[model samples]
Every structure is written in C-alpha cells, then in structure tokens.
Target chain A: MKLLSTCSLRKVRGRNLLIVPDPCSGNPDRILEVTDSFAWLVGHFKEDVFTVKTLAIALSERYGLDDDTAAKEAANVIQIWQDYHLIEP
Target chain B: MAGLSPDRALTLLFPLLRLSLWGTPLPDAVKQETRLLNESDWEVLISVAKNQSVTGLLFQAVDSLPEDIEIPDKTLVQLAVMADRIEASYRRISTASEIVLTELRNEGLNPVVMKGLSCASWYPRPELRQSGDIDIYLPKLPTKSGRHFQTSPDGSLHFQQDGVDIDIHSRYFDIHHHTEYLPSVPSPEAEWMMISLHILKHATTSGVGLRQICDAALLWKILPDNSKASLPIIFKATHTMRWHLLLFSFLEDYFHIQNPLRHISSKPLLSIIAHGGNFGHHSTSRSRLLKAPSFIRKADTAFRFLLRIPFSLRFAPREILPTIKELTTGNLQHAFTADSHSILH
Candidate 1:
C-alpha cells in the first residue's frame, strides 16, 4: 500500500522521519514522529501498494538480510503502518 | 536592539512567522531571506520553530512560494516534505481535540479547550497553525472523573493516553486555580485578559517568541469593533497594560501587524523583545556570553543572569525559587512541588 497523502517523509537533523498529521496519527497532534526504517518504506512505496515480497526484497537488498528475516521485518513494518493508517492496502 | 545581535537565525524564523500569521504576502523579501542558512542555521531555525510551536505554519509560509520567489532547490524539497509532515500534524491535532473534547464532555467535565485550538480559528487556514499539546481547563472535572493528571517539571499538568498529550491548566496565571475556570465564564474580557497575561508572563520571565506574540495579536485582531475600546480598561485591571502595549508595538514594528490594540513602545521594552527572540534565545549561545574575551563582557553576562532573577521571581517563582534554593542548599523536592499557593506573584 502507498503512504497516505496526509503523511510525508521529512529530513530533520539529518535523520529520516515520517511526519503523520492529525487524525491519521490516531490521536490529536499535528504531527507524529516515526522511525527511519518506516520512513524508508514510505519513501520506497510512495505511489503504489507493494507486495510483501517486494518489500522484503527491498529490505534484504538494503540491509543484506536473509530472505526469511527480511520478509518477517517487512510484514511487521507494514502492519505498524497499517495500524497507524500511514498506508492503506 | 540591546539584546539583538543581527542574529541570522531569528531573521529567517521571525519573518516566516510574519508571513504565516498576518497573511502579509511577502513575495519579494523571501528571495534573499534563506540564502545564507547553513545546516546549523537550519537546525536552530527548525528547533526554534518547533519550540515556538509554529513549525507547521512555517512550512505553509515557505510552501506558498511563487515560482518567482527563487528558493534554493534543496530548500524547496525540504519544505515540500515538511508541508506533508505539518499537514499530518494538523490532522492529528484536530482528531485529538475532537477525541479529548468528546471524552471530557461525555464525562460531564464541561471541558473548555484553551490556547492552541481556541486561537486557531482566528487564522486564515486554521490547520496551518502548528499545535502543541491540547490545553484545556484543569483536569478536575465536574462529574468526579477518575482520569489521573501528572505535573511535569515545567509546571504544566498533563493528561497522557496512548500517544496523545493534553495539558490541563487550573488557572490563566501561575498562582490561580479554579475547577470552574472557563466552562463557567464566557466573557470576552476574560479571554482577552488571559491572552494578554500569557504573553506578558512569558515575555517578562522566559522571553516569548513570535508565536506567542502572534497569539496576542490575533486575539486583538479577532475582537469585534465594539469590544476593541475596552482593551485599555481590561489591561489596566490585569496590571499588564504596559506590557501589552509594548508587545502590540513589537507586533506592529517587526511582524507588520496593523491596527494594533495599543500604542506603547518604549526603547527599553523593544530592546527586550528584540534580544529575547524565542525565550531569550538570541542568535548566539549563552555560554559565549560567559566566555567573552573582555572583562566587561563577562561581567555583563553574569550581571544579566543575576538581573533576570527579580523578573523570574515575580512571574515564575515556582520554577526560579526552587532552582535557586536547589542551587544554594542542594535541596530538590521543595523548590518544584506542584502547588497553586506556593508562588505568589
């Protein structure tokens, strides 16, 4: 799934951060801070929804992780994004 | 301009605020504005914008650049990204306010939202304003609710659930608390007085930023024409007439706000506001003041810190007294406990 239009990846102090605006943050706040890996995924999947396999491949290529581990991490990251409505399937 | 040292950082941040708050439409000046900012400068500017609670608005100001404004390509990319983050933040604030206000009302708390959310309506696009924690009247509600409230070291009561934060205030000033604070009173005088005092209190002690000063300006701007005549009387009663006048002048002088609420700007007060951009955080660092190569400069820094004690004592004795007591006697708990009566302003 693609990142929601309401959310954007920002570079703050040289760190990649995902800034999710209100309601989308699942609570009241103008913005919510998220991790760099999550930011990487959002950046990678900016337009189209990517399959779990595609995400795992990207993760494996980026971090040199084994296929199974990358797939698991990709699932976990995507699940978190879905939970926050940062992405939609 | 006593405290102002041609700070490169504030120069960028303050004008950006002017654009955001006043809708003044600066199409030309912005071209040369962000030209010299290095990474360190951007860091400080971003940090100050967040501290002043205006990051989202700053993004809006920069993002509205015309094709002719000529912002650096990298800066434009950064701003486009920041605009996305800020938009998300605006949504989060709106959602959070709705959830918290609904919860509070359902509990018969009679919650009255304060500051950020309340002042936002006066802006051109309400969501463009960056919101901090949702501030509401004291958490002690009407129906004997069980929501626990915590007091942080900075003397604000906060209610946190999941990842959302709401700061509960018992009084408009440092010394007062009322369970029936705002829910019972719908007076415009009370609202204006509170805004005035907030700006005054922050300016005298910690040094306010453009965001705070703009709140005061917007409050004045939104007041009905009939109500405008009463500002002097209200200010006089709160004993903040002079301070309010000085702030209004600064709003007019630097930020380009027109039709000010008052006309009182002396050199001394202007110097204070100019020097203390964003809580007395000028362009230079404080340690540099102490490390001055000249004896006079070193003494000035020491004297300046000492001089600030009385104002600090007057406005925020709750924080300052405890800090001084701790510094001298090495005691901790006594200076910082949460109590309304402990600090008498």
Candidate 2:
C-alpha cells in the first residue's frame, strides 16, 4: 500500500521525520522521527502502492539483497506504519 | 527554496495572508514587496507556520491565491488536504474559549478575555488567527476547575485542559488600578484598548510580532463610532497613546492599514518595530546575525541589552522593572523551575 496523503516526511535536524496528519485537527497529529533504515525503504517505494514483492524487487536491484531479506524488512516497516495509521491499503 | 532554507521561506507566510485576505487578485507586490517563492517553499513554509501556531492563516492565504499562480500540484495537495482539519481545530479552540469563559462567569470568576480570544473577532477571518491560550483575569482562583496550574513569573496561572491553555490573571494590563477602563460590561473599545496596551507593553521591551500588530491594527480599524470617541482618552490615561501611535505607523507602513491616529509620528518607536515579530523571528537580517557564532551573537545581545536602558527610558520607561529583573534573573522562563532547560525539553 501507499503512504496516505497525510503522511509527509520532513527533514528536521538532518533527520527524516514522519509528519502524520492528525485526522481530528487537520494538522500534524504526530511527528515521528524515522530510522535511517526505514527512511531508505521509504525513498525507494513512495507515493504509489507497493507490496512486499514489489519492495523486494526494488531492493534486490538497488542493494543486491536477497529477496527473502528484503521482503522481511519491508514487512516489518509496513507493520510499524500500519500501527501508526500512516499508510493506506 | 533555491537559495533559502525553509526557515527563511516561512517569512513569506504573513505577507501571503495579508494579500490573500484582501480578496484581491495576486498583486504585483508579491514579487517585489514580499519574498518571491515557488512551490518548493511550501513544505518548509507549512512546517514553520505550524511551529509558529499560524497554520490556519497560512492555509487560508494560499487557498485564496488566484488560480493562475503556478503553485506545484503536490504543494497544493499537501496544503489542501489539511484545510478541513485547520477549520476543525479553529472551531474547537474557539468553542473552548466560549465554554471556559461561560463556566468561569458562572463561578463568579468574572475575567476579561486577554489578547488571543478577544482580538480574534476583529480579524478578517477570526478563526485564522492563531489561538495560543485563553487568557482571563480573575481576582482569585476558581476551585471548580480542580486542575493544577503552573504560575509564570508575571503572576499568571496557566491550566491546560482539553487542549486549551487557560491562563488566570490577578493584576495585569494595570487593570486593577483602572477599573473604569473595562467596565463590568466589556465593550470593543475597552477590549481593543487593552489589546493595544498589551501589544505596546511587549513591543517596547522584548518586541512583538506582526500577529500582535495585526491585532491592534484591526481592533482600531473596526471600533464602533462611540467606542472610537472614548478610546483616545483611555489610551492617554494608560500612557500608551505614543506607543499605540507608533504601532499605528508600523501597521500603516507594512499592511497598508491606516490608523486614525495618523498625525502622531512613530519616529522614536521605529527602531523597536525594526526588531520585528517576537523580536525579529521573521527578520532576514536578524536571522543572518543569529547564524553567526554563539559568542558574537551573545556579545551583540549584551550590547543590545545595554542600549535598551537608554532606549526604554526614552520610548517606554515601563520596561525598567522587567528588564532589570530579567538581567538579574538571567532570562529565566519559569519563576519556580530552576532547570534552565526544563521549558525547552
């Protein structure tokens, strides 16, 4: 799935910080600083919906990582975003 | 966005709000008078405005721009998606102010609504004005709220409940000494005068921002005929007419909002306005000066502090106490908190 429109990544203090739109206030609900690893994952697969298979393919081409490892990392990041309501189906 | 950081681009917003709210087409002044910015500036601008508590006004300003202006699609989407939320927050806070005031009145805690809530209605779009806190003056604390409060050095008690900061004041704006200023029945004249005094008081010492100047300007512009008749006398009585007139000049020059007190010159007070909002948060030159090494800026600040003695003595003698206290106390934010970083952290 893709990041929701509300999910805007801001670069603050040289760090990629996630700005999740607060549904109630229509402003930034939470500003969650991203891990360098997750930030890298986001850079490759942004805006458009992407599945584990898609993420694995991009990672294999770019980083030469095995499909299984890439898919595993992708799943972990996706789960974290889902918990935060930052991504869309 | 090209040469400037987002912090610099945020300066573009207040000017944008002024132009957009005019209901006029994007004027030629956009390129020359205000910062010439494009879509690349939007993300940082949005971030900065939010930090400054001006997201509502920023959105309304950009939304009102003419369709022909070439704002990037992504920037537009980012700004537009939050429109409903901004309105919701504004309404929520506005409602909260009404609720708190009504509840306080019921408890016989009759307090005058200070700068934020009272001056909001005077704006072209009241909800767009950033509502920071609901400040009210109560001679005594109300036990009904039951929430614990942190008292600032100025002797004001702040209670945070339901996302609104409710500040209860004892004696300020020198209102206790002049009960006749705001009668039991508050009027626009009284409220605006209080706001002007508040702005002038801060403007003289620490310096104020465009948002505050906007409050005083609009309040003056919108006063009813009867209120206008009585306001000058009140301003004079409060020793704020000179500073108010100076503020009038600043507004007239920057926002094109004319004050009837036009004949009054603000030459003496111009340097204070030069300090810019919240003492030059939006000032390009000040920002550049700040980017200097810490030692240089500290020395510069020290020099400015020394200069303020003579300056305040001439322009605003009321600053003597606060300045002396701040110097002695080392610019502490909380009266009770000893940890210097507590407020920041």
Instruction: Estimate, for each residue in B162-186, the C-alpha lDDT of model 1 and write its tens digit.
Output: 4456776655543222213322244
Model 2 lDDT at residue B290: 28
What fraction of the genuine interface contacts, i.e. the true contacts, does candidate 1 reproduce? 0.07
Off by over 4 Å in 2: A1-89, B1-15, B24-26, B29-36, B41-55, B81-86, B143-145, B172-185, B263-276, B279-311, B322-345
For candidate 2, the per-residue lDDT at A42 reads: 71
- The reply for model 1, stretches above 4 Å from the true place, is A1-89, B1-6, B27-51, B138-143, B151-157, B173-184, B259-262, B266-345
Taking the tens digit of each residue's C-alpha lDDT, what string does model 2 give over A1-89?
A: 78776565544224455666767765677766677767777766666788878877777777788878888866777788789887775
Which candidate number maximizes DockQ?
A: 1
- lDDT per residue (tens digit) for residues B1-345 in model 2: 264464355446547756644554445666442335555566777665554445666666766665545556566556544544555556776788788788778877777777777777776777667665577877676666545665544556665557666677775453322445453336677577667667655544455555676676677667788887777777676555666677777667555675667645555554554344455432332224424654554455556556566655665565567555654454244433631121211
* TM-scores of the candidates in the order shown: 0.61, 0.61
Candidate 2, residue B338: the lDDT equals 36
